[model samples]
Target: MSFAEQARPIERRTLYDELVERVRGLVVEGALQPGEKIPERELCERFGVSRTPLREALKVLASDGLVQLTPNRGATVARLTVEDLEDVFPVMGALEALAGELACHNITDEQIAEIQDVHRKMVACYEARMLPEYFQLNQRIHELILEAAGNRTLSAQYSSLAQRIRRARFMANASDARWKQAVSEHEEIISALESRNGEALASILKLHLNNKFHSVRKWLISQENGTRKG
Candidate 1:
């Protein structure tokens, strides 16, 4: 057989994988609220998939802690408790601090410019009160920093924990005060990165993550209190 003939087209993602991402987005974006039942029928109709693939996707989400599978009750979005943040954020802070330090050593001027551009856009989103867009850009900046760090192991570990708490992180911006404070922190982050001050960047990153934990914790406590009142 000719080498050309032996070559294959790039494989597309499987339907099951696509369903998993779509369903996970629902959970992350709050379309499927925490503790709310996963409406299998509605989703099946919307995605035009059978129960088999959807259930498989739900299983993936459950493993990610984004959903809970019950015996007879089916799946529901998992709630983010203060305890979850308390456990996760400190580790995330340490990881982010390390990433910031390494990024200061390794990142190129062009990479810093790329992050600055995104940071400007994120600031604009904040000014406009576009929480979702701001969050996406905010996430992109951190991802770029991780990429700049050039550590696959750190990236993999951080990403795993990141996926588990994305919804809670998004909710951290629910307060205008916290959001402004976060933006101020981002400014300091960029300045430190631009200066290539590894220690300063590390300190700022740890403090940033710590503040985010406080914001998310406050929001979760408020939510629990509201639930109790209702």
Candidate 2:
């Protein structure tokens, strides 16, 4: 009721959000690796804030399962296992499938045109041998599909999940061949969407995700085997 009280609550919320973004960005950018401890003084100085806001942000990240907080050791980045991937990726695939189905139902002509343009740009990136550029376009196309799904909650949830897997999702595979395969998969997904076939689009999306999962798994296994042999 009082202006002071009202202003305090708003300020608290804003600081909380700012801190959350700071910590999340560090994790996403790999400035903080999984299971690595966050330096308290460094964060305090970098953010130009006090311990209160920094701790609040870490708590929020811990709540998101993005970090683990201990009594004495403080917070460390969350480490994901292959089993974690098995649990998380399928849920992501289902959410994507749901988005694709909804996109088919609610997509506007203008949105379709935008996605088409992105697809064309994506192909151009592939042809130019600019895989990083192509991957960015690929990400934009998927985000567009989720936005066109017209469900705010779904979009937010999917985005959060994607953020959790950002590192693994962006890791390079064995060769450029994998990049080419990814481009081909994106083309099929766009074609299915353009034709307004929800079922086909969903299937393509699932396969696209599975391919990434398999590729990552193979790479991880090879690394482990190499360590064993060494």
Candidate 3:
């Protein structure tokens, strides 16, 4: 079959999903920074799609807490505060800890191996000074861990929450020093899991998330100081 003949026609449903993911990635990667307004016409041209699909994608992103749509001012990347983390992280920690405990009983050897592979790749990215790529792998590792937990509803909820949280973290740090410690922390998590130490894994993961909250707190203070000076 010729390439074009074999290629399936782009489905409207698939187009919307891809558009949402692409636009969400822009915000998550800081390509569209928080509080930055999106130029709709520009985006339509850039994506080579119509305004209808683009608008649909924007609506999805807004629903995901990545963008805020104003009555008249169109859409902009959502600005997150440290207070946001204060409200969200604890619940997320509890859920993830719950997931880890369940995962201990549900995980298969193949899943464990996949997790290990992601960790190894993350370590390599860290060594290569590729913070962005490293963090992406880090996310995959956590997701794999959650999948191993085998709780469908909890996994879906966590993924939604995490999408919002990841956008904030990416905006705040982009490439911060604490990323190094984060890599080492994942090492501990993998080690604990390998030993089937569920309790220890839960504790470590909780502490890891708590530390993130602390870091966000410190960053907020710094931002406040900068604002006062300016």
lDDT of 3 by residue, 1-230 (tens): 89997797865666778999899889877788677899899999999988898889999888877899998889999877667768788888998898888888888888899999999999999899886787689888889989999999989788877877785555455234677777778999998888878898898899888887777667766766775532
Q: Rank the candidates by TM-score, best first.
A: 2, 1, 3
Instruction: Estimate, for each residue in 1-230, the C-alpha lDDT of model 1 and write its tens digit.
Output: 78777787767988899999999889887888888999999999999988999999999889878899998889999877778878888999999999999999999999999999999999999999998899999999999999999999999889878877887777656668878989999999999999999999999999988888887888888888888732
**Candidate 2 lDDT score relative to the true structure:** 0.84
lDDT of every model, 2 decimals: 0.90, 0.84, 0.82
Candidate 1 clash figure, as a count: 0
Ten contiguous residues with the weakest lDDT in model 1:
167-176
List where candidate 3 sits over 4 angstroms from the true fold.
Answer: 1-14, 127-129, 167-181, 227-230
Clashes of each: 0, 0, 0
Q: Would you list the rank order by lDDT, best first? A: 1, 2, 3
- Each candidate's TM vs. the true structure? 0.85, 0.87, 0.81
Better of 1 and 2 by lDDT: 1
lDDT of 2 at 83: 74
Better of 2 and 3 by lDDT: 2
